[model samples]
Target chain A: MEKKDKIYEGKAKIAKLEVDESPNTAQKYGIMSIPTIVLFKDGESVWQGVGVQQKQTIEAELNKVAS
Target chain B: MSAQYKVVILGTGPAGLTAAIYLARASVVPIVFSGPQPGGQLSTTTEVGNYPGFVEDIQGPELMDRMRKQAERYGTKFIEEEITSVDFSKKPFSLKTSTQTVTADSVIIATGASAKWLGLDSEQKLRGKGVSACATCDGFFFKDKDVVVVGGGDTAMEEATFLTKFAKKVTIIARGSEGNLKASKFMEERAIKDSKISFIYSSEVIEVIGDNKVDSVKIKNNENGKEKVIKIDGLFIAIGHKPNTDFLGDQLELDKGYIKVKDNTKTSVPGIFTGGDVHDWRYRQAVTAAGFGCMAALDVERYLEGIF
Candidate 1:
């Protein structure tokens, strides 16, 4: 809830991919739009959020999948 | 518990950032809430040649990012959070983000407007693949390809005209009769004179057919109930936009969903001000929005001075 909360940060590994350079990865993920966030669990995408999303929404999604 | 601030500016558009620049320079130290789209609608745009000062041209996102940095250098604190709701009746107005609550003495609402979608399932699925709401942002991708522009308003005409520079052919799909267009004479004539632009009257895109990209669209006639499919490379929905004011509830008066402003930037609520596309449907340019932001900041400064 606070900015200093590192609980969720410690549980997940975040990776940023450049869709331009990694065309294969982008294509594999079927990423047609910019700023597409895909949550992967065990090398599979469980949830995907497109465009701008609220922090709480992402946190809730993360909580659902992480559990 | 909530963080208290003297001034809180919503949105990170040209308006909000410009307000921050002014307020921060005046030692107001306003906290800016960067809504979902940090750079606002302009971020989705491509080339911005008419914002003034720039000799050549700047990309939409680049201009907004520079504005944000300028505001940041001047002591403006930016939070990448959107206010979900607000209560303006209280002395220090309360606002809620998805996570926590915050309070501000004065508020500037520059949340701007968002494009209206067709709400079709297929349209949602192929948004970025080949369907787009912004022709300026996605027109280049349809170069040498055919595309369809939906709507009968000036925005629809403008988008079709702009697309003609890139797309091989641009088709206008109007759900109303041919004579029942909402576009002004100037805009209609400009679009009509374009050789690459054509119109399909009294028709609607029932479905956007595609797999990964837009292949074609299923259009149905409103009069005779005739259905037809036209192959296209991209679909542009230019139906128009709705202001982002759901969070305000009944705290402020709104005109057709846009916040109503009086005395330049002051809204119906005394301490609550507005700028940009949220209050201005006409002349929704970045420069004009920034000007509004500047005015709102000045008004807020005067209002705060009187109180303090």
Candidate 2:
């Protein structure tokens, strides 16, 4: 929780979805794997990275999109 | 987004997390780069009955999550970054991810291994739908259904045997005759003894038939070029695993693609050490990899004393 807060830190919001519980959302996004991180800006998915990603990289992307 | 660290570990599996736990407890502050599969192979597995310490079997993902949190509790910094390349020619080793580069005084290569897949378009298209690599991970989903495992090796035997627990029938698609199976005698017998398990010799899966999910598999016989379709609820690929060392870029010695270690965890190059499946293809177990991680951490501490 602390790590999550630090990564977002009011710069953005984060939501996690379990693909198994939400098959429709997974199919909508064409997600084929686990641990995929998608960044949405202005209600549109602007950047997406599959697999585990570093917080720094995520934060960097968040900054870019937030700007 | 570049930073420097005294120690950097390039995986987040049992091996890397164990190394981070040890190094962090010693105040080394190891920065761990959680590669593509953050928790590595075990996370994709289902029941881990052999990892020890638990009264009952633990779910593979839960165990890995506990290990990761344990490492984090000890102040280990985890980055969800897959290293793209490495430069180990100098004192400070440089590792590059897609978005940034970082340097470390000492690096631990516990990058682990990835499962191999049949290179077919249909197979790629239906991955995770019903095509899977770990039977223990996906077998429960196939309860009372028919499943096909492709391979003739020990892993294939193991997967087929495990799948018998859930699948109504488990079939092994082998590329060779029963006499020439790559599985050990014991493993072959274990799988053969199961009433629910069957074998198709000298055959290979040519295509995975699926739309939203796996429906069946197209198999071809190598001897007479006859192809057949088998109805199955799931497909499990158990060919083998390849170590994740492509990013090392010839910086260290390799033995058949796995990092070659001379003295336990010491790789060919100094200041660069390895643990887990990246260097160990023999055991390839979570506990053994974690043990190797501890050894590498201790080695890193000693090497740092000599250099720094």
Candidate 3:
């Protein structure tokens, strides 16, 4: 999360956690795979993408719900 | 108007990222969609031993991260979106993703393959915990422990045999009538000849029972319709795999379910190329997928040269 672009990181509500750190949260997300990011808009989940993604990719997805 | 790219690559597993790395380096500026499962089968994989180049071992997710970063360093654009539909019927192929419609001069299909699961709720809940699909990736974790490999096909026989290296005992749950297995004679005989392997015919893994990690599986005898639970350290589901090409409709040629390719990575459609497990069924190794990715990227470079 720290490595993300500064502007994107600044505006985003990010929660970076290990699978072991939050087993219950991981279960609720149905994270069959690790390193998945679920984006939320207006307190509702909008999108989720699994695996290693670039900072720009994360920013684009974050922008979709920034309003 | 939809955004247009010189090249659009789908799926971000070894194949997709590998291609991105090459294309980015060549200044193609390819746009890649990470798909629903970004890292493909490898992300869920705990450890990988056979990918080569690494004398020590590496975690699956870490390897994929390195691949993605390498591509990012070279100007490859990535989108963490899944493509819901594609239209290869005309030039500048139209792809409808979850967010926006995009067009590309060239498309690379590296969506890869997904392992088939027993679809049990417990099985889904404990995927990375103790139940796995690849014996090559997670077998070392259960060294000297008892494990069970479920299936009766060639893949099942292969997984069971591979599990024998680490597991003290490898129980094969052949879901068929007694003494009638689905694996080929060679694979079946190999498992039968291995001293560490045992067989339980006419049984299916009804449930993967465990608290945190997989502790055991509930097996149902297909003949008598009775279920029994056995203690084990790990459960390997070797039923089979289905290629992730359903989104393509029929715009491309397919062999069975996998995309068929001829002349290296070139698909039936000239401008569209493919690599990885989406077209390959013989070798599903990570190294092999990466090699295919390299090929697809080179082919894309050459195709772009001819066009632009």
Candidate 4:
């Protein structure tokens, strides 16, 4: 669902997970909330959140990943 | 050296975004890290009527989206990264991501707390459909309806008391005996005084029986080993809330797991401000969080001016 949102652009990718994807993965990540976004670079996580954020801030983080 | 910002605000909830709006308006240009819960607790909610200024109630996610847009319009930079770690011991506080380590003159922690819920599959299935965590936000819609509240704490007692205004009958489902209520004497007394409320002691909600919305709850009596199905229109989970600050444990001062704030929104450490549920255990409303966010940003601006 996130992949289709077009929220992620320019070298950034988004993925969605079902509630049962992993054993208490959401709980482990302290995600007692929904619609969380976890940003990754080279298979490493960079950021995560529960809702939409501004574009420039995301770009700044993406720029760091690109470099 | 990596780039450094004047301020870095964490959590894009109402508190964080409100702070960002203030700082941005002041030309502080805060870089707001949206955290794991960007729009905060409001996003998971279905409708928000208590937020004020909205003559007609609006969807929770839509309200947050509007706030996010408002903050962005004021030049607040929003980041989608989850800050994995931080080193507050340094002058220019260092925050590390999987991709880079960035520094900021000031940091505001608005990572809000999350309400705990029963791990029942049926409960999860019916969330926002008829099952909710906040009674204050959703109770009005359940007017003259039967509702079930889970937990034995002050929050549960309070929620039960609040729900009575709307609910025809309020059932308090405690995992333990009625004597095991963790609520304060005043709250417990208040719950006991409510004629519309009934106690379901030593019981747990095995399942919320409903197709798409909560219509009943299957309960198990822990002591008597008895089972019963009670009809209800809604389920309110008031177990408690855990702040999203385990990542910052002991790195800053905390009062009973909640981040401790000094003057206004100032934390124990200088240049590190906190707001919302992460720093507040009481008054965890959207308006209060926004107020704290504004204070934190103003304090951050003062701290930044002294250094920058």
Candidate 5:
């Protein structure tokens, strides 16, 4: 999506959270599970899923985010 | 047409590989899927002394690798792939991996369970460096040294008991009162009878203190709202374990997130079987997991014969 620039941007970011890290910061924005991916547009979550997901499905989800 | 194997085993842990050994010896070809953790939980562990037949202590990963080699010697083919999904609602069950889909006459699920740990930086930093979850695996390393076991459940009691055989002193850090043990009366009585064991009830581990290895633990007393430090050489997390069965979906019956199997290692769905930590919560030892794995493979072979 970032390359195509069809009003769609998709980037995979990985963050490692240590145990001592505050849960408040991690739980904010309603993240309840580990390895969660949240799709946001205009600072609002459009879709959220946890664990490993297919690239095609992620692309489809980005379409929803773009619309 | 290439004849499909009689059984397909998921996971390459003691359970899966052991099953392959038995099935291959019984003239059944077993194809094993070496999941993300090829050798399962034991791979992450350092020393494994409790597993029988190893007169001299063996490295956990080395033991598993030898098991894999032994299974392969019996003609078991191993494929390194993570099962993305599975379909057990029909005969000749199908499984989807990251790259391919495979169908087998029967499937054995031995994905095993992962130890649950407190999300602490120090804990992660000290993993395999004095921070361990399996007392049976690492307790001997801490002989005559003080160690801390965290949790209020039966697993905690069991681990503390096992550690007493090696540790000079074993401290149980419970999140509740001493009287609030989740273990049965027998286990609770055993724990109380052991003079080497001490209960730090109503306390939770806030930080694991050490440099390259664990030297002490910072604990918070929930009842008094006070913090204190206890010196210990090792930390054993007995909180709980989560079975790796999320990809199983609703294809098989589950009991509290564990795969449910009958006495014969047969699941509710025919031609599909489960064993090891994935289906067992009572005993999570490697020997028990391997025993169940053998049972699941034999059961899969029988199931296939009954149908074909």
Candidate 6:
């Protein structure tokens, strides 16, 4: 679904699953904010964060899920 | 000499760029490391007024863009990378960034401070929509609208007082009773005297509520387990700011989590100067940061004169 919804596929490392125009996906995930990034390794959320976070934070989270 | 610059300025905010402009014009050939957020705090802001030059006003990012271009025009070399560590113990200070390590004869610490937030999920969601950390920067957008400010310190008092000019009603959410307020006598008295300003003692903002924009805030009493929702048009977090000196690794002196400077921008160690929000706690304005940047540049030039 994110493959169809994502405007651009900048990096192929991680897939972006967004439900911007539709609120159903957000409601399902209890997401109430924009720029909320969630890391999923095996169809399950491993880590998540909100707001405009630093690159270090995102990289650390990605490393955690990857490990 | 294995390639050492005359000076290296950390950060790309108003202060860093201004220093670069002065340094480049003087032919000192300064290198600037623009940290994670290039253009710093100003990039997050929408409009910039009281910056002195632009009478018609300009966007915050736009103002920073012009400053960066001006610095570049003067031959200021820019690096969009983060400095992971710095070794200022010896001459020709070594800096390790995300990409490469560089050395500079003199180093200017222009890394600006960041505003503290409540770390609330809803608060994070509504940022730039109706929630802001700076009253002076975003209060104009809340004209004649009800707003709330968080914090019990002098910063909160100052923000609440400043918001009165634009907000119809300003509510201060202090963590404890009024007696627990950390504000000074004059600042507290100023807010207390303001007709538009009100207080909610022994309270904390638990959650922010809104769909498109902020329409209300949920606050909880510290003593009791009761929560109340108040309609609000805007929210300001006046909990103060933390300086960007983490990478210094206890090398430079810090006073209350901020880099301490004397005679404007001179740090405790010679040839190592600090400018912008990293040192200026009284007025964190862009203009003042630029002034500090100018001072740091001249100080570095004079310091380099004795070295080479």
Which structure among the candidates has the greatest DockQ?
A: 1
Candidate number with the higher lDDT (4 or 6) = 6
| Model 3 chain B lowest lDDT segment of ten | B134-143
Between prediction 2 and prediction 3, the one with superior lDDT is 2
Q: In model 2, what are the clashing residue pairs, if there are any?
A: A53-B80, A54-B80
lDDT of 6 by residue, B31-145 (tens): 9988877898888666677899888879988999999999999999987678889888887788887657889889999999988999999998888678888776667667688
In model 3, residue pairs whose N, Cα or C atoms come closer than 3 Å (at least 3 residues apart or on different chains), thus clashing, are: none
Off by over 4 Å in 6: A1-67, B1-3, B118-149, B152-172, B176-199, B205-236
Can you write out model 4's per-residue Cα lDDT over B1-308, one digit (the tens) per residue?
98799999889788998999999999989898777656888876666889989999988889899989988998988877778788999878999876778899889999899888888999887776568888865676576789989999988998999899889999899887767778888998889889999898989889889885678999999988899999888899999998888778578998888998877888888889998889888899998999999988888888877842
Which one wins by lDDT: 1 or 2? 1
DockQ order of candidates, top first: 1, 2, 3, 6, 4, 5
On DockQ, who's better, 4 or 6?
Answer: 6
For model 1 chain B, give the 10-residue run with minimal summed lDDT.
Answer: B134-143
Per-model lDDT: 0.90, 0.87, 0.86, 0.81, 0.81, 0.83
What TM-score does chain A of each model score against the native chain A? 0.84, 0.80, 0.74, 0.52, 0.60, 0.67
B71-176: candidate 5 lDDT, tens digit per residue: 9998998886788798888767788886788888888999999888999999887775678877876575676888889988888898999889889999889897
Clashing pairs in model 6, backbone N/Cα/C closer than 3 A: none
Candidate 1 backbone collisions, by pair = none
lDDT of 4 by residue, A1-67 (tens): 3543464465565556664455266445434334445667777666664334444566666667664
Docking class of 6: incorrect
Interface RMSD of 6: 7.4
For each candidate, C-alpha RMSD in Å? 3.6, 4.2, 6.2, 9.3, 10.7, 7.0
CAPRI accuracy category, model 1: acceptable
Docking class of 5: incorrect
Q: Which residue runs of candidate 4 sit more than 4 Å off their true CA positions? A: A1-67, B117-149, B153-172, B176-199, B204-237
> What is the C-alpha local distance difference test score of candidate 5?
0.81
Model 2, runs deviating above 4 Å: A1-67
- Residues A1-67 of candidate 6 have per-residue lDDT tens digits of 2442342243324545555455576545544344457776677766666545566677666656554
Query: Rank by lDDT, descending?
Result: 1, 2, 3, 6, 4, 5
Best of the candidates, TM-score: 1
